[model samples]
Target: MILADLQSRLRIALTNTLVEEWTLFTPTTGTSRPSARTIAFHLGWYLRQTVERTWSVDSEYDRSGMVLEQAVQFDGDTRHVPDLIVHQRGLLGPEHNLLLAHVSVDEASGPDDVPELSSAQALQRRFGYRYAMLLDLRLHVEGRRASVTPYWQWATLEKGAESPEPVAVYTPRVLAEITERARRAGD
Candidate 1:
């Protein structure tokens, strides 16, 4: 499958689930907000949906239990687990034939975390994944209504780069464009 096609599908799934579906759910607490694990589950679910929709064959996605072992400059070697991982059908191992997504939910008033990006870059460099996306969801809640804005960064081994740069802030229109482009390319 084409990498761009898969990426476009992922972008749409994330935008719809986070920006649209998440806001409608009522929070349990008056002040407390969704945690990183909560957001990770949602993102993982959407990623699974995208994989199922795009591929005809079987595939596997995990929210946990998969680790990318990397050798850091001073840390010797450490294991890093991404929020979501996608593996091709029947080939299940710690190999690099997988797609990865790392998620961070930033405070409403705070900037997107830099460490997340750095870690993602390190993973890309070590694993040489075909594609890796860093998703930072900035959340703000007013009274009972929640607002979420998503930022995306993508890394590809084709570029031969250690790190990825900020790509686009996700929106409904952007998702629509991606869908249309994929459709056109298919035709």
Candidate 2:
């Protein structure tokens, strides 16, 4: 369809995934859940930060740890949803342009990663995001309490930005705890 339609669809799907993960962790809790808006905002922040930056690099080593979340598609499996995102950048001034690109915003859009393309080198050239972050949400059980994780990060894909490799991965428990306060507000 259109970019607006696709963006909305992605947001909805991401929110659903977050909530689904949340439920899996806190299955017994009757507490209010985080809002879709909060998840989307947090995700957006990461997209603008991590993915946009490193994915554009020309590095040959693993860049997973440095980023909040990352995954590469292979074989016939192709469905992946990253938490944070940077839509698109402007050709002129930063203030004049937005992070969300017109095409990617579409629901029928294609994947950013091309198998033949190098993860770093093709990042910006193919995707064209100014920033990127992938939220890693998972369930953690400690004693009798359950928690959600949050993997928020900020990075840029601009040619001028730094190109550090990825590092350790964050779990859903970490992410939920970090944003727990604001997440409560979302309920």
Candidate 3:
């Protein structure tokens, strides 16, 4: 599948899984919420499950062994570590065998988190990966109630550019459409 299509499908799968399978909030003394690491783990798990369930078995797309804090080198010298890297199965190394670099974000994330996205995008440009995705799980705490909103941003490599441009925003309606499409395709 193409990059956009894969991104759309994955977004749908993640949103649905988050809404249906998981509870977002737990009671705590002072505005407790899910940490970025916890969110990342759930995202990775659901992403792998969705890919396995929806994609064709013959496609040979393996979402296993998603590494965390993987150090990658580019430009012959510079090295950067990203939060998570998803690549095809049987790839020899991660330097050039990345399918997507997922940057996780939460309420505490800020400008410091941006460099990771840039680094992932740079790697995508150098290696011609389909896209890089940022998965932001924003939590809002009010009194005793907590709410979470999930945002998906896709960066696609633009022609002749060194880094990717924000190509699409995966909103709820788009995600719903993609989910329905995936269901129909599976049937």
Candidate 4:
């Protein structure tokens, strides 16, 4: 399929998940449940970030490049879509190996990878997330305005675990800043 077509299909899959099974995205443990838009934005942000990292090896596409293969659920069932997936293969069906990927950023870290946060020690050093960014098929959703949705940060995940006990949420203002920069650039 053409790149545009593939992207459209993938988004369709994301929407389908939100409409039919977003409830399944519950923390599986926590009492708080983020909105669908938040989830979508989280997934979208994760995907965009992955493409950026992958672009180092596959220069054919930019950091934001991805074939766009959408679906709900970790297995495209119930109600769960992962945040991101690697766009390795050309525009086609699921990869022979895998497509979806998960990601998380540690807001508490410094540029030097210093131990700004407890999870900093475990991050991929440069781009690795503080928590497990599992690639669930149901990830990736649109948020308020034109932004990626929010993502779930499981307490069991390292980011939360390593964090200083309780009230662990990383709302990176960096994305909003980037969005503003992009908007200004386009303007």
Candidate 5:
């Protein structure tokens, strides 16, 4: 699929996920925010609904049989498990590797924790994915309810692109309205 079409579909799915699964973002029991992996799973579910049945949406799928190269300065394990992926299972080529995404909630310790533009481009080169996305969602926890802040940004790197582009899926006003609805639901 073309980059614009893919991005539009992804935006719809992501917006649906946030609107429908707001409870996941806001925990009734504790103050702790949901993990990125947890949110990705839900996002993947929504993405699956938006795509054709042939497309498989998975979260934290590490067994793609592709190994990522580690940086010389970093001694830690280089196993790069994408938070979300859209592709056909068992097809290892770029044709089948539609999208690769890394998601992070709240504050990331460093670039390693959340892949930035350069790292996203490297992943696209190594994995041969048509697109790479970095989704940064910040949680604003108030008592038992938490809402995703408008500060969230979606950065995307297209195939052979020099740098990643920031795309606004929805207006901050829309996000605020949804957040208010979520907050009301919690009460």
Candidate 6:
């Protein structure tokens, strides 16, 4: 798929997840930061609906059966499992590895602190994915309520480039509107 089309579909999936899965951002109980995996699961569900049915959308799927020599080590493991991936299940090449995404929720870290961006780049280089993205959702918990703001950056490795280009899923104004909608829904 083309970059613009993929980006458009991603935006729809994110918007749907933010609006429909608002509860995941705000818990009625203790105010703990939301889980990145949990949010990615929801986002994957929506993304699956938007993408072509032939592509399988999965999370933490590391059973591709291919040897990753240059894979980044994390948490004492050499295997790199992306938070989300879109690809054909049996094939393991650039033609099949369409996209890979690393998801995170951080309240104190800046974009520079996001190590997932590096992981994304490594996975894209190793797996030869056409696109790799880092979805960093910033969440703040105040008492029983929480607020979330989403940001994303992507790299188009189709041309064998290593640098990732930052992309905004939502403009500042639209992001504020989405946050307000979630807050009102929670209230």
Q: Quick one: best TM-score, which candidate?
A: 6
Q: Per-residue lDDT of 1-187 in model 4, one digit per residue for the tens?
A: 2333433443444444333343434333244434434544544543343343432112123233533332311322222223343344444322211233233222222233211223322222222222222212222223422333333222222233322422212135743554454344433
Lowest summed lDDT over 10 consecutive residues: which window, candidate 5? 150-159
Off by over 4 Å in 2: 1-25, 29-123, 142-144, 152-154, 159-187
TM-score per candidate: 0.63, 0.33, 0.58, 0.23, 0.80, 0.82
Residue-level error in angstroms, candidate 6, position 54: 0.9
Between candidates 3 and 6, the lDDT winner: 6
The digit string of per-residue lDDT tens for model 2 on 1-187 reads 2333433444444444444444423434554334333445544443333333422212122223343124432212442333233332223333212232111111112344212113322243334444443323333445545554432222444542232532223445644544464335345
The candidate maximizing lDDT is 6
Q: Over the stretch 1-187, how does candidate 6's per-residue lDDT look in tens digits?
A: 9877998898888888887878787767345656778888988999999998889999866765555554444322444467799998878787888888877777464554455556666778876788988777777767666666676788777554334554556888998888787667656
Cα lDDT of model 3 by residue, 68-117, tens digit: 23433322244333344455544444333435544444556554544445
Query: In what order do the candidates fall by TM-score, top score first?
Result: 6, 5, 1, 3, 2, 4
Clashes of each: 0, 43, 0, 26, 0, 0
Among all windows of ten consecutive residues in candidate 4, which has the lowest summed lDDT? 120-129
Candidate 5 runs further than 4 Å off: 63-67, 71-80, 108-112, 150-167, 184-187
lDDT of 6: 0.75
lDDT of 2 at 80: 32
**Candidate 3 ranges with C-alpha deviation above 4 Å:** 24-32, 52-80, 92-98, 114-116, 126-128, 157-187
TM-score of 5: 0.80
Q: Looking at model 3, how many pairs of residues clash?
A: 0
lDDT for predicted candidate 3 compared with the true structure? 0.50
C-alpha RMSD for every candidate: 7.8, 13.5, 8.0, 15.6, 3.4, 3.2
